[model samples]
Target: MTADRITGITLSSVTLPLKAAISDAKVLTGRQRPMTEVAFLFAEIRTADGHEGLGFSYSKRAGGRAQFAHAEEVAPDLLGEDPSDIGRLWTKLVWAGASAGRSGASTQAVAAMDVALWDLKAKRARLPLAKLLGAHRDSVRCYDTTGGFLHEPLDRVLENAAASRAAGIGGIKIKVGHPSPAVDLARVRAVRESLGDEVPLMVDANQQWDRTAAQRMGRALEEFGLTWIEEPLDAYDAEGHAALARSLDTPIASGEMLTSVAEHHELIRLGAVDVIQPDAPRIGGITQFQRLATLAEHRNLTLAPHFAMEIHVHLAAAYPHEPWVEHFDWLHPLFDERLEIRDGRIHLSDRPGLGVTLSEQARAWTVARADLREGTGT
Candidate 1:
């Protein structure tokens, strides 16, 4: 038997429309407008052995076009490469677009490719990605975010939290950091009361606050007993986050925006956070995520990946520590499968790889696409 090689690759740029314009702290703070859609880069890899794998990366509000463009530019480099060599291939793609640098859109573009290779390997082994990576559990604790954006009225936000709790979601996280401090406090109080006690609850400031504001909100928020206060300061402000962590009884959580392992290391090294929320797609995909996971585990920190429940569920399941997965149903329309949520957890299925297949609806949503074969692409 001979090792198989990748025979072809396909990439699609998908525009997924949000049901309504959604706003968060960034929008309220005037940094970005409400987001009406998300851009996705989906990569499908086929090997000579006829095994296929699918992976995708996404951007919201901005950078979707950049992600697809960069993936298209560097995707041909994977032709004829061994699909099982995920790490080396990741390094290969990074250097292929070295001039564009190693993080942000550059790495984000290739994240789909890195993810596809991992999926391919797991499918070949007939195991789910979590088992392929050595799962610590079959089901991961999950929380819902779709219902709690800053744009929703307090009543609507409370309704969302109530619905999620009834649906077996283990936790609820609501947005804070409105320009009006009183408004922020009121919403948190409302949801906390609606949820009652015993359910894990958290809040995200989305990095909209200065140190003074973060401290004020953090102290005021103490009575609710949150699981964590997320992104209370700018994501890269490791020193500031460390200070906030020390000052607050509520654990500080940040790092979803850091684009590389090196950037996340600053958080780990400074003891900046009690919970580290790394998004696999926004970083460099699973290879980079695994590296960050190990670093976080060593620090005895809680692991809670930011979003993409489909991807994060598997990664969280594989973590040695019990970790939480953000459950957002926004991407539900793109895939043929749905994650099983029961008993306040996201359960993994036995299906090989990521346990997902793209839907016809996904194809209908594609705006641009390409195919690459040995020595040729179209």
Candidate 2:
């Protein structure tokens, strides 16, 4: 039987305050400010046959106000398309913004709808997303990536690391670049000392350093045994990233800013990064990521996706060397099915589609935030 076509698309915005403030101590770019909360643009797509899918677009900056605008503007373009023909739909949307540049905000907007289509397709197939994508393993490994210097004290950071390790987490990621390389080095060394040798430790500077500083600091911290260094330079600096990758012994990982497979291809061909971290919300959704993963596989590299652990957990489970999924702990309160991570492995649910549903209370709570509706416009 032919799959039902996409008949309608709806978009909405929500803001949720973080349990604690997230600060980038390693202010590599803009002035470091305390982030009040996260904002998301959630899209729901419905097909002619009544199957539906859900996807979200979010940002730590501006709480997703601009992203929501992009989604609202693009929704009409997706009306009446075949949900099953995700590739075709993605191409149309990518071309919709061809005159203006298909990569950044436009691509992020397309990713939201594309992900919704994939979710809808999985639900229509009556299969979990990982199964629909072709599951390579039953459970995927995950690492905690939420211990920020702004909220968690040094003692608390160690405590969280210990708790995660004891809980059977296979890896941990710490935030760095609060401006002092020495402090960053100390923090990473402490975590490594605490976790010992078995559990992998990753660090994200959040685009906090220039090439020279990143190389200098990265080399200093290399002795601590980091699994990878993420976003050390600006996300857009492919050549800088390549230089840093060549300079360091630890793997260089970036690409949360990437929006298409072409960019990934260039980065791979240039040997810009060792590990590729594509955010499903930023990179034209799951279909493009699958294609990128295939390319990375052929190049003898690993796929370590960034953010949205709910979605990445499924994608990671379907790959051969997708070692770790980033665990930010932001989506737990919003969804009914909080992922289960036992012994560092994320176990997928048997429920149809993505197996995530927003709680009524959460929806109401999100709607009640009037301040977020004002839109910070970052």
Candidate 3:
């Protein structure tokens, strides 16, 4: 048999329109407007032996085109490389785009290719991604975030919360920081009342709070017995988060906004968060994510992966310590396979790789495309 060499790579940009505008603390603070859609950059790798693999990275509200463009520029470097050498290929793509810098859009672009390579390898091994990574469990604790976006009314939020628990989701996370601390408090109180004491609840400030507000909110929220308070302050404010973690009984979680492992290292080193929340695509890809995971595990931090549940459920399961994976329904239309959410957890499927194939709807949503072959680019 011919050795499996990457023969071609195709990148597609798909726009997933939201049923209604999505708003969170960032929008409420005037830092960003309501999000009407999400942009996904999909990388499909075709190997010499006819195997194909797919992986994606996403952007909310902006930078879709930038991620796609950056990937296009550097993807030609991937042709003829061994697909099994995912780490080395990731490094090659990073250096190919080094002039554009390494963290934000640059690494985000490389993340798609990096993930695809991993998926390809896992599929070749005929194992699900979590199994390929040596899963600690078959399922991961799950929480719902989409149902509680700040854009919805309080009643709708409550309804979503009740429905989420009914659907076997283990926990609920609501956006806090709506410009009125009192409103946030009222919402939390109502949700707590609705969900009762047994169900887990989490709140996210989305980094709208200052030190004073975070301190005040942290104290006020202690009564609720939340799972954790996420993004209580600016993501980069390690010292502030460290102090808050020390001061409050409720665990503090952040780092989802950070775009690299080195940046996450600073957050971990500062002892800023008791529960660490990292988004794999935002930080790089699975390779980079595993690096960060090792560091977090060494520190013995609670793992709560943020967003991209299809991807994160697998990563979370592979964690030795129990981990929580955020459930967001926004990306559901993009894939044919639906993750099983039962018994308050996301369970792994028997299918190989990520267990997802692009839906026709996903292909229909494509707004841009590019292709690179061993000898030519299209």
Whole-model Cα lDDT per candidate? 0.92, 0.77, 0.92
Model 1 steric clash pairs: none
lDDT of 2 by residue, 1-378 (tens): 875666666676778788776777433445757776777767778767888898876777663766666666556667656678889888888787776467666777777788888888888889999899998888887788776453566778999888877776778888887666777877887888888887788888888788888988888888887889988988778889888888889999988777778887877888889988888887778878889888888887778888898888888888877557887777778788877778788888898778887666557655412111112211
Cα-based RMSD of the predictions, in order?
A: 0.8, 4.6, 0.9
lDDT of 2: 0.77
TM-score of each: 0.99, 0.90, 0.99
Give the lDDT of residue 294 in candidate 3: 98
Candidate 3 lDDT, tens digit per residue, 1-378? Answer: 557899999999999999999889999889999999999999999999988888899998899999999999999998988898888989999999999988999999999988898888889999999999999999999999989988899999999998999999999999999899999999999999999988999999999999999999999999999999999999999999999999999999998999999998998998999888888888889999999999999999989988888888889998989999999888989999999999899999999999999999999999999988897765
Which 10 consecutive residues of model 1 have the lowest summed lDDT? 369-378
> By TM-score, how accurate is candidate 2?
0.90
Question: What is candidate 3's TM-score against the reference?
Answer: 0.99
**lDDT digits (tens) for residues 144-263 of candidate 1:** 999999989999998899899888899999999899999999998888888887889999999999999999899999999999999999988999999999999999999899899999
What is the Cα-based lDDT of residue 124 in candidate 2? 84
